[model samples]
Target: MTRSATTPRPDAAPETAKTVSTGLIIVVLAFCGTLVSLQQTLVLPLLPDFPNILNTSSENASWLVTITLLTGAVGTPIVSRLADMFGKRLMLVVCLVSVIIGSALGSISDSLMLVIVARGLTGIGTSLVPVGISIMRDHLPSDRVGSGVALMSATLGIGGAVGMPLAGVIYQNFDWQALFLVSGGFAVVMLVLVMLVVPESTVKTKGRFDYTGAVLLSIALTCFLLAVSKAGTWGFMDRKTVSLLVIAALVLCAWVPLQLRQGQPLVDIRTSLRRTVLLTNTASVLIGLAMFANFLTSAQQVQMPAETGYGFGLSVIETGLVMLPSGILMVAMSPVAAWLIRVHGPRIVLIGGAVVMALGFVLRAFLHGSVLEVMVASGITSLGTALAFAAMPTLIMRSVPITETASANGLNTLVRALGTSSASAMVAAIFAAMSMDGMPAVPRWEAYQLVFWIGAAASLIGALIAAFIARPQTIAEALRVPGEVVATERHEVKRPEAENEVVVGGVVTDERDRPIKQAVVTVLQTDGRHVDWGRTDNAGRYTLALPSAGRYLVVVSADGWGPMSGLEDLGDADLDQIRMNRRLLLTGHITDHGDPLPQVMLSLIRHSGEYVATTHADTEGGYEIGLPPPGRYVLTVVDHPTGRTRSRAVQIGSTSATLDLDIVTGIPRPRRQPTEDVPVR
Candidate 1:
């Protein structure tokens, strides 16, 4: 009976069941996400009431919202790293609970300080959306993962859009406390749903927590975000802002060296440095800025009075009602974005999204008056944002290892948040700089035009980056390779077989005669030119097609086996078969007598008169070279960093073949002690 080739082990049935469970979890999480997004806009209508209620200036009241943004910027990356280390489910619960407690507190509080604290608490939950998307990825099936991610990403826009109308209705009819009460109630429901539906997801990572790294990262992010978020209020040139930015720079500079030394790092800094990851993250920042600019500019424009030179004069509720179409459009577009990703691939989808976003901005530059015009601009821009957001996580997921998906995606989200924070500061600056009359001047319709032009420019830059940065081929491309080339004609090359044509075939075995699979057989010519080749089916038996062979060096190698080599004459008649004696042990001690050198890679190169075979030592500095036939072999060991090599000749099989050396001390040690018999493979 013909045996089957190796197939990938099927995923556990329970895992499949859990994947289905992710949909419900995402829905619940999205509901909670809605509450978090609602907080961003819920206070917009109440902006006018803040000064009266708190008896504070407008600028002071603004801190209620600003503080939350600042906290969110600080909290996202920290929470993301913790999720990578601990458990995603646990972090989700913690985030939701923070939102619930904050909402409840803000609903009951009369003081502005209490409300600001409540907002900060809610900010913790707001940062969880990216984390939640990442968690869903761990459980969901590949087929379902994209749509699930897109839907979750859409909540970033949906929650904000829906929150506005909801908040407007509550603020107009009931007290401002009602807004917080509704948010708290929604969060409570989400919390319960999450507990019931969300499965536990924790990536296994080895090593102790990098407390120092986390603290430094947090301090740096806080300082950087604070400076960006408050740039308009604290002038860009202000010493306080400049000082904070410098401190942030210093913290980031110090973080790199510390991370490299740690075995288990909080962030995969080296992996994130890849072109695909780094560039995608950079583009995400620009896209985020553009997305937020849409929110800030359109929200303010829609609510301004018709009598004001550039205002449309719609009530808060009417403004939200008019903007409702854009939210609906975003919801409608998400699945389409998911479909585009599946059809064209993520790189194409990302590039297309950037182009579309830029086009939307260009259109907005011309059309910025009626409620309909603003709605159209919002809808168009949101469609592009949805496409880009959906593609980004997919890109990050594909570029990274399965283990680092959540962490990488989390970092991407953090970068995007930086962009949004910067946009907030930039918008404030634009408004501040464009004053016309005695009163705070409304931006002429032309100001919105200038903002859109800037947005278009940023989007174009993102498009160029995505086109250049992504890998040329993906996993799917690799899978399709067999059919990619078509055979037109066959060409054959013939060469004379040597007098001693050794038909070498043998079962590659371990110390025990167990078959080794995929062991490589190398035939080294006397000249430097040599042909190295492989294949021992499930039963490790390899055959080499000789090329004008004379006395050639033959070598055999597998992972656990000690590498073996021998000199053989491939004479004229194909020498029927040679059963390789799996003996000859090459072993050694790898220790830094003073300090442990954990990252050392030990390689063994055969330097016999005419034979050569190479293999590396395992993590423990122990190495084994395997061979089919035994002969004289010279062993050469090299240290990885210094490139210093040591060599010694040893006879194999003719006498008991056992070789040993101490790598750290660069000293030749005996294969066997004077009394102890050397262990043979």
Candidate 2:
């Protein structure tokens, strides 16, 4: 799995001994890192020009930026996992290539669709920051790792801060194509540096690809993000929006069970759920939202007219000039943040950074009229962002296993992107709601002030979450242990041994009394304790160990077969034989039947219980329900086209054995009327 880059061994000497200089490597990688965030903000000023250039509506042109953000949000975690599985250097180079190609395509494109596609391609490059940061740790000396990480981390915000004014300059002096050409030049430079100085790390793991988890997660994320991003454009309560939301929910429901069952998951759901990782990610999201307020307010304020009673009325170049100081402040503050982490510790630094960011927002809320006020506010906010961004990686690295450092960091980055995307959508919605007569008429001052107030509230919440995170301390200091700090609090719970034993027998069948495999048998006490459990062998036989002797309820469950339950006295015989009856056989055909209904999925549920199952009827409309346990069940059939559904309750075992269903026809009648004797045989 090794790539061409230098693979540093864990016990090997620091990268300083290598022929290449450590400082040179940092600069090279940092420049490459700059391309990602740069792409995001560089397009902001050009958004106004999209409609005329592409002959598309303003809303359609807006997707150029929104699509890039959405793609980056989805791509970061996926690419991070790939980086770990393959090689960091390889992934980094691949990302740079994408940026180069995307920028080239965008530079020459005349159609709005092609430019949007190019922006998405460039976003794939935007996902490389976390991967680059993780690789830096592997190659840099321990002494340099802290500062190196700080610089790399700050690049996320720094690029955006710097890109704004740069974009304005390019947009004013040249065509919009110049922005793409400039980014393409940056990418070309990074490609050269990546090949020469950046060394690869040896941290690797062995596992098969978790393709199932990846696909399901992607679908869930795409659906969910589309719904959220479109909420502002389409009414939130719109039916299409609600339908996408529902689909997203269902896909997520399926994803959880699938991930838990897989041995090697894409994102470590278990570890990510722990208090340390969980709190850090939560704080990251809030901080991301707070940090994004800077971009929203600054970009709009600079371009707005001073006559609007709130804008500084700065030209594009002037706005870039206004933002220049904040970028400088951010870079300057990175090393200081690194030093603070070494002394006062990361937890305190993170909390302090959050509080400071909150204050910056409040300052913006009160004083955001003149260029001076905006500049001061930008500096304050960027400084806080630099501090918080620097501390997060240290916390995550300390919390997660060494093997998952890059992947965990990637997920942390994704959370931040999620928060930013959410903020973008919220800002769009607020502006849209406040506007009148198709123009932004809301007092420019109030609009900026409201955004700052929102940011302040978000930062305050981040501060509170950071306060609850356990501060990093030596194991001996925290638990009185001798050598190291052990993660005792976040340890997984061990399963308890059985306290008692029991055996049960069941006759499994597939409607014709044929035996079934993998049937699950269990005994549940009244107190919610599982007294005994076992899986049925090929012969439909099972045994279980009881937790204690008591009156318990026995249940048998199998996939495709209905569940069976009964009372059992474990203190007595502890042995029981259960028979499962073939409930209802709701067989139906799926076809146009004069009108075409394609890809129809049928769902069935037991009237008295939560037993449910789904199946897709073939084009011929032919479908059958396997052996259902004896009970009253509700059967529902649905077609995607009309969303038309038909439902009815039919008693199994007692009613006629054969029941036919039709989608277009009226509900089928029960074979035996209420006055007739329902067959119980």
Candidate 3:
């Protein structure tokens, strides 16, 4: 009904029109991501020499690496959630600022602790990838989102690959301080470009920040990451590691329920648990585990001493060059991945990627005869990583609320980092325990083979997980606005400005005028073409984008309440307070023949095997349970003592309805004598 002054309408004057090219946006964001990721491995080449450089123990120097992982794990979700609440571009700028400040600090300080602190600050930039992906979803035209996201996601691998050689060159020539100074300069440039180029999106969830939940989550992640990352050195059975793990487990046990109770949680646990999001995230972890093995092992394998039969004994610079093609292949495969995602939905892309990765690892396990073979094998895995990485964000965004895209993608990124961390621990353990006998032990070729086999197994497992992701039945279903119901075939309701979007905001309330929190409001054309959908906030407020002004169907549904739908001629006006009166209560009687079946246990299960409700019949055989949104269900009634069960198929409508079940007639039994005391309906 109205437009904000800050967010000019699409038809605004030429001066206010969007002029930035999408290609420039993608490049700016992707390069920003490249710069941020470079921070992760920038100091990696200096790890060995860090003890002397900082006058600290080797273990302390290792924190230069471990600290980044720790802070990245903690910062990503918090920054992502903030991005959704405040603004994506704002957070992007904030992350870059963090990188700039951290880099500057590192350049000026040689103190081991101070540099570790600097690295920790730079780790906050890890949030850049997820937030950048969310921005692309908000800004890019629908057609460009796939390829744009592909290149952005691929940057994670690109930076890691580029960082090694880039850092080696800097370390070889200039002072080590130049590494931080160079990265800081890039961060400064990115910060300036992002402000000048990227548009700050208006899509945001209105809610109070969940500070308590964030604190608890941070503590849990810190403990967990420390335990996992240090377990290789500390021993898995070490008391410190075990204690940290236990603390993390207990804290998470507390955090999940707390999140469930929050109106605006740091993470939407319910949405995250949705079949698509959950499975995609699971596959993400496996993919990360499989993918990182190639990155972690490739250069090391090439640089092994010549005494090792499979070693090339290449210098650091040469090893980095040898591994560089994998990153190049990842960039080159971005368009191909996008094309596959467009032809086949993200589900298929994920599955295909997992399979490719599995085959690549299989090749790695056996094909070490020459540098060319190793490069090709690793490149194949990187190709798959590009595909999988690209598909994951698409799947997640499609499955989550548009308002929570940044937070959702942030969680995906977090799980992926977890996968990478686990891989690091696994590789370290395997190599350490299986090394060749020498004063300075070298990992045997068999150890590398074992790692490759495990990597292959992980990839295949990821493929299996991706295989289980539910596929959308139509192109519209796949591309439906995030947080909206699937579009059903319906007659087009032609109207002016069919291609334009109208911002619709409203509150959902009951007949008593009580705000209904978390209700799903769906806007569709009369013919069932989904326009948009949204979830009410704590105060029952929602916002959506309508495709056009015309007669349309507005559907609202919430837990413990009946669904409501109606038709209205919607135009440049907010779909104000939609009142829902009927509460869906499935009530009926259960009887055995003509007799009441008292105390019978009744369970309503959906056709897809999701449990909806369970209750017990009263002494008079009356039972009532609140129903969920209308769906096909099996109403199963069982007598506890006799263990006799009867299930009747039911179809619930939009409003409440009554259903009387005859238990005896619902189930077939062995024929018995007429005098036999068998319950009858």
Each model's TM-score, in the order given? 0.69, 0.68, 0.85
Per-residue lDDT of 159 in model 1: 77
List the candidates ranked by lDDT, beginning with the highest: 3, 2, 1
Residue pairs with colliding backbones in model 3 are 490-527, 593-680, 593-681
Question: What residue runs in model 2 are displaced by over 4 Å at the alpha carbon?
Answer: 1-16, 436-444, 476-681
Q: Which candidate is the best by TM-score?
A: 3
Writing each residue's lDDT as its tens digit, candidate 2 over 1-681 gives 011212332223344346677788778777766788899888887777889989999889988987887677677777888877666888888899989999999999989889999999998886677888777656665456667878887776668777877887787789889989999999998998888877665454335667887787777777777777788888789887788889878987988877655545678776687787899999999999888877777767777776667776777667777777777787788799877876566777889999889989988877765788878987798888889988888788666544456788888988888788788777877777665344654434556667788888898899899999885343221211111122333331212222222222334445565666556666555544333344444555443433334566777666544466666665445243444564435565554454434568777788976767788777666666663666778877787778788776767663334445666674463443121311112
Q: Which ranges in model 1 have alpha carbons more than 4 Å from their true place?
A: 1-22, 472-681
* Cα deviation of 586, candidate 2, in Å: 43
| Residue-wise C-alpha lDDT for candidate 3, range 469-549, written one tens digit per residue | 887654334355322223223321222223344455677787798888888887766666556677776777776655445
lDDT of residue 523 for candidate 3: 73
Instruction: Write the number of the candidate with greater TM-score, choosing between 2 and 3.
Output: 3
Q: What are the lDDT scores of the predictions, listed in order? A: 0.67, 0.70, 0.82
Each model's Cα RMSD: 15.0, 15.5, 7.5
Model 1 per-residue lDDT tens digits across residues 310-343: 6688777777787677767776787888777666
Better of 1 and 3 by TM-score: 3
Give the per-residue Cα lDDT of candidate 1 at 242: 99
Model 3 TM-score is 0.85
